[model samples]
Target: MRVKCTVSYDGTGFSGFQIQPGQRTVQGEIERGLKKLHKGQEVKVFASGRTDAGVHAIGQVLHFDTEIYIPESRWPNALNSLLPEDVAIQAAAFIEEDFHARYHVRAKEYRYKVSRSEVRDVFSRNYAYHYPYKLDYVKMREAIKFLIGTHDFTSFCSAKTDKEDRIRTLYDIEFYEEDDVLTFRFVGDGFLYNMVRILVGTLINAGRGVLDPYRIPDILKARDRSLCGKTAPGSGLYLWKVYYDN
Candidate 1:
């Protein structure tokens, strides 16, 4: 049977989502619990995408196959018992045999949080990026508008990325500010490695008045990695949501 699950995790203590030999990872933990469920039989969990190290997730989706019969409603409780405290199975359902977690995705939303307060938020140190510098939010919003359609995102992707085709469709980019917290949400059909982080870094540069908002188009047209700004910390990023059609 193919089982679909929605997962949430605090990525502070994890190496990353994918399995890395000699490292403790979210996939490793989930697979461990799944093996216990199958009485030591191994199972592989396929996620929609990999979140870089230190990136949290509010709604991550994955699917796995198993021969054991466990009620879908009880998957969370059963799996949570075996998994570590930081990782959790939020929801689960039986899916069609051919349903795929990665290829079937329609779009994904990623959120980056920045604390604008001058005071250090010790409690939120592991959760958000602290940027006390005065930000020109108005200019940042204007810059984001230039990235709201299909384009080659090579400038924003990491140099270490293995992806060959950099073309991607960005559905929208929105910014919100309340109190001392500034947030940005990016919705796209798919993302290349470190794409969202690099995009946010460039936008933040615009906010800091280091880069002109209108120059974003030229950067995109350049298609050069050097044209992008510094990449944002993974701690400030979250896998906000994964969308799929029923």
Candidate 2:
């Protein structure tokens, strides 16, 4: 049977979602728990996508094949018993064998938070990016208008991205502020490596008046990575949700 699971995690303690040779990671820990459940038989887990180090997730989804027939409702507790406190299985269900967590994804939503307070909150230090600089939200919104549709996002992704086709669709980009925290929510069909972080950084620059908001179209047209601003820290980013076609 193939079991699909939705998970949430505090990624501060993880190296990343992917398994790495000596570093602790979310996937590594989950697989470890599954290994124990299967009496050492390896269980490979596939995720919708990978999150960078210090990046959190509220609704990350994964799927794995298993011979065990534990009830779906019990699967969460069964797995949680073996997993660490930072990672959790929120829900599980028996899924069609052909369903894939990654390729079948229709869309994904990500959120990045910026703390505009004079003094950083110690409690949220590992979760939010503290930006003390003044920002012009109006300018930021103007800049985001250019990024609200399908386009080649080459200039807004990491140079390390191996995918040659940089095209992706942004369904929407929303910004809101509450209690000194600025949130940028992005809904897209797909994202390249570090794409959201780079976009956030570029938006921040525009908000700071460091770059003209109207120049966003030129930057996108350039398709040059160097034309974008710094990549925002992963701590401020979250895999908010994933969408699928049933």
Task: Supply the global lDDT for candidate 2.
Answer: 0.96
Model 2: which residue pairs collide?
A: none
Cα deviation of 90, candidate 1, in Å: 0.7
Model 1, runs deviating above 4 Å: none
**Lowest summed lDDT window (length 10), candidate 2:** 115-124
Predicted structure 1: lDDT: 0.93
Candidate 1 at 130: error in angstroms?
0.8
Report the lDDT tens digits of candidate 1 across residue range 72-179.
Answer: 899899899999999999999999999999999999999999988899788779889998888888889888889899999999999898988999999999999888
The TM-score of candidate 2 is: 0.98
Model 2 C-alpha RMSD vs. true structure (Å) is: 0.7
Please write out the lDDT profile of model 2 over residues 1-246, one tens digit for every residue: 999999999999999999999999999999999999999999999999999899999999999999999999999999999999999999999999999999999999999999889988887799899998999889998998999999999999999999989999999999899998899999999999999999999999999999898888899999999999999999999999999999
TM-score of each: 0.98, 0.98
Q: Give Cα-based local distance difference scores for all models.
A: 0.93, 0.96
The per-residue C-alpha lDDT of model 2 at residue 150 equals: 90
Instruction: Pick the lDDT winner.
Output: 2
